[model samples]
Target chain A: MARFNLGITDVRKITGALTEKGYPDFAGYALMSLKLSLEKIISNHGFKESGAMVSRIYSDDNFTDSLIDELSVETTEMFRDPSMWRLLRERIFPGIFGTGDKIKFWLPGSVSSEDLVSLIILLKESDLTTRSAIILTSLSGKSLDNIASGVFRSSKMEVSEANYTKFQGKGELSEYMVKEGGKFFWNKNLFSEVTFSLGKSHLEASATCVNCIIFRDKMIYMNLTLSNKMLDVICRSLSGGGYFIIGSGESLTHTLFDKHFSQVDQNEKIYQKIR
Target chain B: MYKAIIIGGSAGSFQVVTRILSSLHKDFPLPVLLSLHRLKHIRSGFVEALSLKSSIPVKEPGDKDHIRPGIAYLAPSNYHMLIELGSRFALSTAAPVNHSRPSIDLSFFSAAQAYREKLIGIILSGANRDGAQGLERVASLGGKTIVQDPDECQVPVMPKESLKLTGVDHILNSSQIIEFLKKINRNALD
Candidate 1:
């Protein structure tokens, strides 16, 4: 509990400073997440005081970018919530495969490459990779670059492997990775046709008529107002009868966009646009 | 006026929690926030089980859901539930703390910041130290803090850890805790 030492006021000061510096308005970001992430950024970057951090944020462009990069939530793991992945592999992917001229998937808010990698592996296993166009977007170029390079933390490999097993993958997850300098580098060929988009918010991300969008757990960080705004964009991006998936525990029931999508699987939080 | 009651419990604490919730009047004025360790994948059954004897509504609050009085909000499995400013619930999928995702410490810390002295935090029987630091935070924020008496606890580790952390306002058994809750509800009525 003491670990999250920053108060709500500190969170406001940090977010407010960033907003005044021409960053996206984070007033709608969940306050507790902002507080915890700010506490981490402040401590990790060795900013002795919020005043010093504010001053630095005002004067330094590179530091501001780095700060924003640090703040982009990267909580996703490969094949997270295996049951959802199983459903995607066993049902959703097969149904959508060969549907479009090129099955387009737009995965937004990927601060880490695990979710994208997982999707690519699934597509490859389903023999749909060649006919697919994947557009991955993120708030930070650094995250996009990391995804492009295929470099990931070696530490997460074990968990990813376990999730893969539970996801009922055809083969070992390690078959697709190589270890170098204590880091796991994924097969870059898998992402050869992938397009990466960097944007500050959903409105700036370029994707239209996408057949599938896997945006899990990201909305938990946003307040209702921001969520509603983002949901409008996400809902519009998907074509009629397209699939949408979110974190197992997340719900769109309270949002205005709920009416546009009907539930596909309640446990997996999978939905299909009803049009 | 007390705005909410936050309770943290883990192993061996379920029955005690059921007792407390079952005993509460349907018109209990404070929202009860419960953070309990549960199997991450088994999502549907816990809320139903708790709701079985609970006189008031028991819900697993969605992210950004409004915090209303007279309902018990159980922290959803695999997500960290928080009390954000403006009396709304916030959920996080950030890494777990003390190996629990709906982390007891995170919930208590956030609720303490959100409600301050108007909050009541209770630590119940459990097998771990997850709620100890949180109970300390509650006390630090000027909120009333209580821990189930260790001797009466099924596991005793959770309550014992709280006793080690801070000078809690009360150390009560299950029945006494229920009485304390009734008294507070009655006082709010007056």
Candidate 2:
């Protein structure tokens, strides 16, 4: 399949078509990013053109989920940014443990299984596996299933192992995995206590509260309007004095909710809700 | 008139980048976006080193940060910097392309689409062919393309690859690259 560029006009048209078909409104995504994603999705899926891709997405729910998965970009690796994990282990987790309440974490949207597996390892190492509860949600059921399975590509292991070294894990990351048919699969029991939900609306509908909300790197794809809307939901879900971690290159400083949180770690983009 | 300038380089392009940034007019009229390969783990020093002689302020833009004139935005380590529709920056943690996270091709691809004929893309010295396809996209989009003269490059592989891929608007050495930018600035001002 030959690669083709999706111009801004094409992006807007596809976004409109998908939303009209009852798919989530992705019109708020950054146009250039969406354009590139659409281009790749078309080429990778061998869609002869954008119109056919859109038609298939409109008719097939599973294909739409796959498209969402691709658009979200599966780039996360285990223990990504080891310093952040180290900080969580050495300082943040201990502080949360001191609150004398069960620790809860909410990861909204289609977070990668690598991230979930990494968190489970952290919990096990800290001996807090039974004391913490995690809520994971995504627009795609396939993504939720992926998180539950805990299988990941071996290609990412090299970088992940290096990150684990920097994170100073108690044992090698490989020690926690069973290699099967060239893929690394973690024990599914590690997520035995996790709660899985279908979409972002689940967080709001349940009025779920969390001790920390890890919604990192996902907002860069959203426009300011959608970002702020999601921030409102995140702020509501986070209890006062709770932690909010984001991507290092992302900032809440310009958002409408900046006044509600104070920066705890500038370089790591960690924030604490003051109100 | 050029709305922005993007330069992609790796390996031996640091000194070349520093030279160009140092000599660019302090009030340069367009935003400068840079995607240079760097050590992912050691993040604090590259900006400081580049800013040492730069008359214009250099920064690593946070995700969604709005683009501004006269400022040079360096792609953050471990992320792909993309130009968004609203003239803001969008950083992605997508897997590295061509074994590089701050892949020059990814940056140039997005910028060419966003700015079209108003964009200026330049590929500098590097040891890989990461920016070759990107220069081709820029040329196809009607954006101006440039490559550091391969003969003058410390590692001629990148520029040579770009030249092989696209007919760039200019093949300039270090000083000539600066002169070209200054000329663009002067034209914008006039």
Candidate 3:
């Protein structure tokens, strides 16, 4: 196990410094440390202390652009979890399609285009595309640019195939991508109906309410308080009878939202807006 | 003969399982057990998917199911499946270990206590060091320990981490893993 050795006093000092610098919670510290560690920005003092220092810096409005640039996971793929996609197609879309109202889908932490593409495919297959609009948002501007360009390494195709199969898929996983000049180009049709945006979770919630919101795998890095607050924002943005899908491994067990949403499918982590 | 073989994996695992099972002849002996880390709330039809690519019978394990040869048993979603002494399988709703339920460590640890030397433990592609400690218990009890070659693994962290923590007997790829199992079965039959 990867252990972090920090004394109580150390935790207090770090927490105090972070509060003084205005970081919302310990997650800013963890995220900052992970970024710096990956970038080899700090060493010798161990990751915990570095995390504290990063948290302190992050809370300051004057934190450097280079520092922010270090804290991103740029590699995300489409049809990442095909079972979830299939679940959305079979269980969730019919309701939205039946409404016949213009639908909006929010995909936060959409690092690359793969997830957006997956959503598009699901909507298309469900015949919900004509009535739906997608908002693909990510914390990193660079990731947004990469998605807009729609270029990716060919090697990722093999892994994507394996992931697709793991989800009990029915279609040929390869039908979604094309190989071009040693790089695999994602199906262009998927993105034609989507809009990509650059944004962060810490910012105020958007005015455009959505029928479904997906923030998968992103909250595992956040602390409880921040995660709950963010969940609140998500709940606020969701229209009544909307849906929220979290990462499969994540839970709202202790949160106020725990009973507010009914589980659509436990394994896919899809939830329906119940209350 | 060993009644069951349990395998565990995390990150970069799907390919490893594919390779291991694909190499088996249709009539290979013994039931195979597996516990893999998947998205917590999502149902992964792993058995159905893997069955399409392998000759052996594959299905998610059920409570009190008999451990039969020539079948592959997968731990179901959100549950830890263990092997009982009398060729029966047990399921538990235990809390998550190392932040994961259906944990590789929990299944291997339980199997180590129950099956002892009769168990075969295989650790495959994953990012974390979950199975390293439990594999130690498996080895100490005379159980066979096989780790996928870190070099060949799509995600080498788990295998490499195990190498650092314990003394394992074999490090091979997916194809070689099948061959090793066949050899073990052949020797046991003799």
Candidate 4:
């Protein structure tokens, strides 16, 4: 019900640009981007008194980068949703790891590398680390490298420990990290089995059918069309009977891929790929 | 010596924080910590812009940075910011709470552990019930708790939910928040 004060031409022009840029849901994205740009421009220019200028700048792309950056929520944590990990360990992994002939685990859109690391820890605890190959792919090359480096903020140890306890983790979370001058550094040995790569979701690439594919919390940013397309890609990337996991808040109910993937653990957001 | 003040906001929050920061004096004594729901892909120029708009210094919190008075620290775009008792600020790449990273709950819970009775927790405009449990934790630990007036907030779910969960010390609008902060500071100074 929010009314945009922008002219029709401005709206059309912005919409066209976003559409041409391969954004499937142009209108919603444009509206959100415009709102964020308006706020940033008004505040930065100290033009609080100039409402007209604020409206005019809303549709402009000059502040697009900054606005998008501010609006994007890249918050993720290690072993987040420990229950999901618990389900993966106790229920999912026992079946998958039992086959254990060089299992491949993939995490698409792996931001900051926490979830991927969490998977690695779970794999290690399950005695599947030596036999598994972990692949972490993200658009941000920097984040990929950071994951490969295996460094983490020391302050996270407490919650990570709590999460470990919640999952009934056998070993100490502290055993995986070392304190270095107030910073908690993750053990590099964990990464000895992980492969970090930079890749976009829409790109044409090939990944062998893996044991599991964890794409938690990435689909909410995309529109239904893009989400469907991504889901198609995910289904193709996942091997037969492999696992696919997503954020509990996100649903694939409307997507065509839903029928192809059967829910293994609904509350834990885990699904198994079927024909 | 002033302790930290933790503020949480989500949907419809940009304006709320702006108003609160605009109302406060530049010399506000306590170290202010903020956790706003934001995407990880975005480059946060939020602190710089907010610092320019307000009288106080604003910066995205760095790992182990000491919490200094008169400066405002924001949880980084993708990380949760926490306060340690020795006036140190810690940042973490922890999992999302209530489906949000840089969660108000994470910061508030960490501050409760670090500052205990000295903490002042505030829940402002947001779409979800993220800060409700965190505020309860604060109150249980004898920390001061405040919720933005649900009637006045751009998004009232957070404050309203917090109210439902526990008894808050105050429910005020952005305009009155400055006065409340000043009153608390005066009591500490006294």
Candidate 5:
């Protein structure tokens, strides 16, 4: 697990390897970061040769999915960014789901299931699991499966529990989870109404109107044209008066984002789709 | 050949950063990326505060904003700022590294990959060891590395830790750091 330096030649080789393997679109993205991250994965997984690694990634869908999984950011926990989570729990959630109305949620780029589980924890508190449905989707199918299976490291649970406590939840965070060996799993029974899908684009790509689109932090990879394109789709897909939350640092300057969604919570990057 | 400068600091590094930035020539032709740990909340105008003493404009770049010479870009709060080899920047909400959101290591490593020997990395005063290892990476990649001399730092922990590890190109104090940058800017003219 020694850190290695990559030259421009290595970047070109890896970018070409990825593009050659059917993901030609990733070349313009953070290819070097992905390259180095993949190198770390390759070393940890005992794939000594990157050429052989690329071949394995092409030959096995599971390997590719796992690679995608490794590349995703998993630094999430229950009620992260305490103030924002508290706002969602106190103000946003009750306002959106009062009176037991049917509500729909779409979480794009739902990385490593932490954010999804956190939201489910909030839903459980409000007693909205039965009346609400959440579409947890990512470009990689494995992320959706990970959400469905709910496998995560046991050590991570304590950190998440602390965050939940910080948010002042009604009960212990682990009360909703089932632990096995070194990992913890969420009880599927508690969130049976939630559905998992590999959503290719934003919620706009889907046929259904989403009441809340939590596309947070996913726009960081997209350029302006792509961001606006997805924003257009988000505006089209979001139900009137629905919420759209981007990353804390991610308010695109595109005029359309301003025109289509009004900033409801600037610090939290929460926007309300205009009626 | 250096096209950009990357500065990483935390805790008490702001004053040193503003000082160095303020002393740079207004027409300095290198994009400077400032990676300082910041509060995730407080969405408005950290860049504006830094720009008050700066000769050149300071901006907090959006996710895909392109880097331009003569401008200083502050890493936005709660995100990891990464360079894309070209003049453009990309950001990530990836988990914090070194217990920091704008982890100095993330940017230093990424900039090393993109700019290699053509980048200058500066580590300033901080309470934590976030930027120390990243400076090693920058130096290893042939990029020039500078650490603020520990004695003159507001908080010496960061620079002292970095000095313990790497034989960086320069170890400078606050005023010396400004003089060093001024020298680099002058060298660019020649």
Candidate 6:
């Protein structure tokens, strides 16, 4: 019952701004989250446009990075979900990709390379690296640059290393990255087959006949409308019976996608493109 | 109507949760969302263990699972589970808060945003201070707050932190917590 400044009018203005930029469901799905992010921006970098009207500051570089960072879900540890990774290693990899088969993996909204490290290490250990090609795409060119640089904040190294240990990943996980002052830069050589693109993302690709398409935690950041759009794009990208993985907590029961992807290992949230 | 029951804890709390849950039947009226800290890389059947201990059906929720009554949903390991706008669970692999992936504070705070005062948040025994601020947030929003009596706790740090941080409605032992829940169920029926 406390008075708050943000109301319907501010939502309309911000919604209008985002819609004008061709994004959907910001008003519905991500409104509160966006408002929370803007609140943090105001708290962090003093308010340029005060109280309920953060539309003006939405385009600022710092503000934009903060928004994407707030919305995107990329703090995955190396082998974060052990069962899912184990499933991938023990079952999904062998079941999907055969010998001499080239891997055209479509990884969209991969702002950070933690999940990529887990997947690539899987590929490397599986000896699929020689036949693999990973396409990492994101909306922000800046984040892609960070991914390309292969550097993670030094503070995160401890947790990532610990997770790698739990993953039973052999050799040194630290060997994958070199520490430069406060940041740990990943070895570019490790991702020799990975491609990073700024615009015209993997989701935009039509009929991408690929081995695996990972559209994980990206949906959690997006509004329902955008998530549906991305889901449709993912469905279009994968051929019938191709491997597709999503965030384990994500529900793909949206009626539009139900006919497209048959739930395989529902607990792991892996779905096979049935159509 | 109360939309959900949010429980958070870490080390030494599982048995307490199992004890509380065992007393509740499969027809328990509220959906229980748990954001317990767990090892990120180890594959432990923690939910399965709890399911066996309790009559209530327990499962680690997938991303965006509809919040439903009569079932207890555990936050998936390596993801910070959130309550989305439409009574759905959204998982985020965002940076670990308090060095925990399925951070208790994240669940309590995000679930508070959706359910507001129509939710119950309970903090139980644990080693870390993950859920203290979150329990405070729940109480401040007019939602009910309970913490395990730290004296009875196997590891007292978590509940002790909650008691210190917030004006919790109850500081109960495991049996008392079950009684509290049964009382709620009875009140709902009445």
Clashing residue pairs in candidate 3 (N, C-alpha, C atoms within 3 angstroms): A78-A114, A248-B40, A249-B40, A266-B41, A267-B41, A267-B42, A267-B43, A268-B42
Residue pairs in candidate 2 whose N, alpha carbon or C atoms collide under 3 angstroms: none
Error of 4 at B130 (Å): 10
Best by lDDT: 1
Residue pair clashes in candidate 6: A150-A186, A249-B62, A249-B63, A250-B63
Instruction: Tell me each candidate's TM-score.
Output: 0.91, 0.95, 0.54, 0.53, 0.81, 0.84
lDDT of 6 by residue, A7-105 (tens): 435656755665555443455445444544444444555554443335543555555444544445466656655567777877788876765567688
Residue A54 of model 2, lDDT score: 72
- lDDT at A108, model 6: 80
Best candidate, TM-score-wise? 2
After superposition, the stretches of candidate 3 with alpha carbons farther than 4 Å from their true spots are A1-70, A74-77, A162-180, A187-189, B1-190
lDDT of each: 0.85, 0.84, 0.67, 0.69, 0.76, 0.73
lDDT of 3 by residue, B6-82 (tens): 78898889877876687776777777888888764455567778888887888776444567888887777666555
Question: Model 3 chain B — which ten-residue stretch has the worst lDDT?
Answer: B88-97
Off by over 4 Å in 2: A1-3, A200-207
* Superior by DockQ: candidate 1 or candidate 3: 1
A192-247 per-residue lDDT for model 1 (tens digits): 86999877665564899999998888888887788888888888899999998888
> iRMS value of model 2?
2.3
Q: Fraction of true contacts kept, per model? A: 0.61, 0.69, 0.00, 0.08, 0.53, 0.55
DockQ of 4: 0.05
Error of 6 at A258 (Å): 2.8
- Which candidate wins on DockQ? 2
How far residue A1's Cα lies from its native spot in candidate 4, in Å, is: 24
TM-score of chain A for each candidate? Answer: 0.94, 0.94, 0.74, 0.76, 0.84, 0.84
- Model 1 agreement with the true structure over B1-190: per-residue lDDT tens digits: 8899999999889999999999998999999999999987566899999999999999999877899999999999878999998998888887787888888998998899899999999999998889888889899989999999999998999899889888999999999999999998898888
Model 1: pairs clashing at backbone N, Cα or C within 3 Å = none
Model 6 chain A worst lDDT window (10 residues): A1-10
Instruction: State the local distance difference test value for candidate 4.
Output: 0.69
